[model samples]
Target: MFYFFFAVAALITGYFVYGKIVESSFGVDTCRATPACRLADGVDYVKMNPKTIYMVQLLNIAGLGPIFGPILGALYGPAALVWIVLGSIFAGAVHDYFSGMMSVRYDGKSIPDAVGHNLGKFAKQFMNVFSVILLLLVGVVFILGPAKLLAVKIGFNLDKNMAVVVWTGIIFAYYFLATILPVDKIIGRLYPLFTACLLIMAFGLSTMLIVDGYTFFPNGVGLANVHPKGLPIWPLMFITIACGAISGFHATQSPMMARCIPDEKCGRPIFYGAMIGEGIIALVWATLGMTFYQTPEALQATLASGGPAAVVDQVATTLMGPIGGFLAIIGVIILPISSGDTAFRAARLIIADFSKVEQKSIAKRLLIAIPLFVIGFIITKTDFNIIWRYFGFANQTLATIVLWASAMYLVRHGKAHWIASVPATFMTAVCATYLCVAPEFPLHMSADYGYPIGIAVAAACFVWFMLAARNTPVEVDAVDSPGVIG
Candidate 1:
């Protein structure tokens, strides 16, 4: 109980304190015209209230990250809570705020263009492909995850395969429509309600935890790792909880909300504050995870038997009872749908930006979206576990790039760069090492070997950054403008 309360309070407090420190460092200029004001096309760049944008940003970034990621990450025990609190405040929220503010400062450009502007033309070129692939992966994963959940909830009266197919088609159709629709029309209109339900679901679960005296961090709840496979804490745990703590996917989603923010001042609450909200949501979910099964061993075994969806079903029904169970199902269903639509939309904009195409008309939007959707739909047929493995690495890798780009932006524009650089350096190592040792990835090396390799890569990056910073003279003005078309 105390653990959950401290985390919640700390997240809220972080926003007022650290959030401002970040805002002041970013040099948020309230007078500067935002994309919504400077490039109002009434389609994607429509200006909305901070309140609405906050809700949209929250729903988009939070998605299954807080719920799914935390549940899986909690398999590591109490240590997971430490990462959720520290990483969210220090790393995750910081990443989101910088990315969103950078977008605002640069006419809400897709993160690729922002990367190019800071890291150089070559980096931008690489990120363009990288960002698109990541977004498509998110789209595919969200589609499959929620579809399966809802299909399971519907029962086995109908053919399970057919149920999955039906749900897939329904989800993809909505993704297509939402992708091409105007910013304020669908996502903006409906996300607030979804956010409401998501929050309620979080609070409801917490209520269950309290009533049940769930030992979130009691003496029995061991903080040490207890994974059945002995998945190393360094990389696997980091990968598992990417969303709640920090995720590169949020960088991609930020521009969607950035295009709607009314002012530079709105950036803090919409970007940073929303991340804090996600952190709180993550804490609640992680706490629920801590208390859900009798022990980490039981949780791991259950996860092995039934997978994450099964875990969700058992907990919702077991702890929350039937009514809470239904609402939990709704919240779970909404998680990916809200994020999935935006993922496809972000993918479209990323492609359009790369090709220098305007998105004011639905026809042009469809022209770009068809190929993307076709690819995403095909990916759904592959193994979910494989896609997720790639996603965890890719998500953090994207974040690493953005963090570097942010550091570069700060340097060029003459602000403190260490804030971004430090995290960037750490995430770079996490990605570099995870690939070398992770079972799903190609290397298949021992976990012991991966750590040294990770350390070397991080050192190499830090040295390279220092050398580059010293050699590369700082620029007076920012490279990217605030009115460039997507």
Candidate 2:
């Protein structure tokens, strides 16, 4: 419990202290006109209230990633808490802030464009495809995830499979509408209310934990691998706990809010602060997972029998009572649904930006969105577990790329590049090691081979960055040039 409180406090402090350093390095220019004001298309680039943008950004990047990820992450024991606090402060929030602010500097273009400016055209084009596929996966996963949970909730003598199908259609319908609608109409308006429910659920669970004196760590905060399967803590825990710590998916979502930010001044709170807020949500869920079962082994048993959704249902109802539990379940459902809608929306924007289709027209928006949803619907039929496993790897890989891109951005501007470069190097190792050793991959090598290779790969990448940094020309007027940086 003390550790949990300290972790939360550290996250809050990190937002003010480390977040400020990031904001300063990025050089948030309040006097400069934001994409929302400068490129007010009324569709995507509409000016929004800072507070609303903050809430929407939180919901956009969060989804069930923070909650579900941390629950699974708790299998690794108290090390999850250490990762959440440190990762959110140094890696995740910084990655998110730069993703959003870089978009603001680039006239609210999608992430591919932002990467293109710094990492060159090939990186931009690569990210364009990589980001779209990841967004589609997120949309489909979120759709199926909430649909199944809601199916259980609305049991009416309906076959569970049929109920899931019914809810899937309903969620996809909502995603379609949210994808095409004006920014302020659906996401901007509805997210704040949904975000409120999410916060209420998290805080309510947190309050009960404190009042009841639940023991978060039965032993001292030891970094032992308590995973029932003996999964090593190095890469698996890091990948499993992506959003709660640092998810690259958040980078894709950040630009969506970047277009809506009314001023540069709100960048830190909305982007960096949202990541910290998610870290808190993740901490609450991780605590519940660790304590509610009384042991990690028991938690693993429950997980095997019912999966993460079932765990969420059982925990909420058990701890919060019937009424509060129902609301808490609704909050859990809302988590993914809110993010699902935006995932599609972000996909549409990415397609439009790359395709050069002006999204101001409703016809053009649908042209981009219909094909995307069709693809998303097709993906829903695949094994959810397979997709999720791949999503975690792909998600972190994207984060690694974004971190490198951000590093390049910083290096070009002559600001401290280490902030982004260090995390990029670390995640590069994590992703590489996972690919080599994870059973899900084709190689499936032993950790003995994977560990050394991962470190070597990361070192090579760092060397490449050092060499490239010296050669790449610095943008003298990065703040003024929309053709390069704003």
Candidate 3:
């Protein structure tokens, strides 16, 4: 029954989200020739087919967060899978795709820039400040936690200091290559190979677990025991599924990819396809987490002792012996690096947009990278679980804001206003309430850190939106002038 629901939800949500991306990009003629839609000559603006773009976007968006978020979500047992899939399709994928298209329509601007244009200068500054702080927080949490887990698997002593040093070097290498090497050459060839490896490793591990007859839920466990917050599951469901639902990372990544899209038609596959890949990855991890650890207590124990990568490694070893363990380690190592690369690139783009720095300049890129590296290093000493929880809260808050902004853009463009606005408004309310009530919930991290940060972000978003509404509207006619996309 659990597996059935999981698989069904995955397929349905995957199709819906992917289809929305395609429809929004091509159906609305957002991809038509315009100055804002033109491709640049360099790494940030190279052209590519939809398929290649899809692969790059998939690899970039699907990261350690999906793996860990589901593991965390499984605290509510198999029931959590339902919300993970549904919310991901409606909230997560929509936010990512539309935000990307909105950025393209606004001259390849990011979420902050869009906010500034449609809202006001204050909204833009608020978003920029929050975004940078949130990015640093996310980057540090992602790099250090996963690096520590990977170190343990690879026999590197797994100390905090060593993990920071090693992952920082890895991030620097990724950025150096991405900035120096041609994106078309690298993403075209290297990404496919990387994706293949990931698929094979993930499939093999999942197949092995299923073959071993690992149970999805532990014996004697019931709904009452699974979620101590009681059976009215809406709030826990909303908070548990972070990136699988909506994330700030997408807001940054979509635009970074949008800048290079040669035509508007390509946006559907790149934006929506990337999200489907991310949803699938989440399903795989959620299934593994549920199957590997029979009980919520057992899963919590494993995570507490060594974090999620350790649990994943243990599951792999249980299924495939030494070879599976090796593959699991490799998979874990790749997850964070792939995400870190995306994170670094997105952070640089956001910085460039906010500061008006010339992205083409190597010196400017280095300047952007340096402070990010330093901040990432400084936060490595913090508790991984705490950081992860805080990031989830911050990300959800950002997602709510972005979704509202995207819906507003759709309305302004005279699209399906109600269709977009209803879901956007509902999700914002649900997520906001969840964050407010989360501190009293049964989840460990939620009560400790997640809910509080969520409340603060929600409050700030509310204020920002109110202020933005007061600003005089930017002339839509001027923005839509001949040869202009923004």
Candidate 4:
């Protein structure tokens, strides 16, 4: 109980202290015209209330990451809690703040464009493909979970597979409209309510757990490897907990809100604060996963038998009763739907930016979005485990690249680059290590070889960054202005 509350307090405190320092480093200029003000095309660039944007951005970057990922991460015991607190504050939030603010600074360019601006054209081109694929994966991943859940909850009485198909079609239709429509039309109007439900479910369950004395850390938190499979804590836990800690996927989502933020000052709360909020949710869920089950072995058994969704249902029903279970289901269903729509939307915008196509025309939007939806639908037929495994790796790899790019942005703009650079180095090692050891990767190496190789790769990259930083000239402008991506 004390540990859980302390972790929550740490995240909140991180937002006020470290979040403020990050905002200061970027030098937020309240007077500067944001993309929404300077480039209001009434389509993607329409400005809305900052509060609404905060909720929308929260749902956008969140999806099933904080909930599902942390539940899976809990197999590693309290070590997951430590990662959630430190990773969210130091890496995830910082990555998000820079990704969003950099887009705002660059006239609302996509993340690939922002990455390319700092990293190089090659990087820009690579990220263009990388981000689109990641978004599509997100769109597809979010769809399957919700579709399956809705099918079961509704009990259509049709063939179970058929019910899933019907729900998938319904979700796809919504994604189409949400992608092609203006930001305020589908996403902005609906997300706040959904976000409220999501928050309430998280906090409500947390409160009930506290009342039940279910979340007390009787073992007083240790670093023991508690996974039933005995998975190493180093990279596996990091990957499993990507969304709650740090995710490259958030970088893709940030640019969408970047185009809507009315002032530079909103970046901290909307981006960094949202991440901190996610961390708290993750902490609650991780704590629940740890304490709700009798033992790590039992949690693993429950997971293997029915998955996280089953665990969530049992917990909600047990603690909060029927109404709470219904609300929990609805909130969990909304999690991916809210994020899935924007994933497709972000993909459409990324493709438009890459192809130099204007988005003011509905036909033009369809030209990109149709193929994307078609591709996403086809991907749903593949193995979910394979897609999720690759998504986890790709997600972290993207975060690693974005952090390096963000570090480069600070290096050229002449702020405190270490804030980003340090995290960049750490994620680089994590991704490198995962690549070497993960079964999904072709290398199929053991942890013994992967660890040293990963550290060496990180060290090499750090040296490269240091050399580049020394040679790169500093700009150090006191004020930011709209700039061309080239």
The best-first sequence of candidates by lDDT reads: 2, 4, 1, 3
Better of 1 and 3 by TM-score: 1
TM-score of 2: 0.98
Error of 1 at 437 (Å): 0.8
Candidate 3's TM-score reads: 0.83
lDDT of 2 by residue, 217-252 (tens): 775578888888888998899999999999989989
- C-alpha positional error of residue 93 in candidate 3 after TM-score superposition, expressed in Å: 1.0
Listed in order, each prediction's TM-score against the native is 0.96, 0.98, 0.83, 0.97
Q: Distance from true position, residue 473, model 4, in Å?
A: 0.8
lDDT per residue as tens, model 3, 1-486:
356345656656566665665365324564366323464757576666667777777777666777777777776776656666666666676777777777777777777887565445676778888877777776666566556665565435657667656765675566446643456766556666677767755777777766787665554324343743343455555555677656777787777677777777666567765676676667777777766777677778887887677777787777778876776656656666666666766777788888888766777778887777766677866777677766776777777667766655553454443434445555665566665565544543544355565456556655544454344243444233221112
**Model 1, range 17-77, lDDT digits (tens) per residue?**
9888888888877778899999999989999989999998988987777888998988787
Q: Which stretches of candidate 1 lie over 4 Å from their true place?
A: 219-222, 481-486
Model 1, position 277: C-alpha lDDT score = 87
Sliding window of 10 residues with minimal summed lDDT for model 2: 477-486
Give the alpha carbon lDDT tens digit for every residue of 272-363 in model 4.
99999889888988888888886888888888887887787777778789888778878888988998999999999999999999999999
RMSD of each candidate relative to the true structure: 2.5, 1.8, 5.0, 2.0
**By descending TM-score, how would the candidates be arranged?**
2, 4, 1, 3
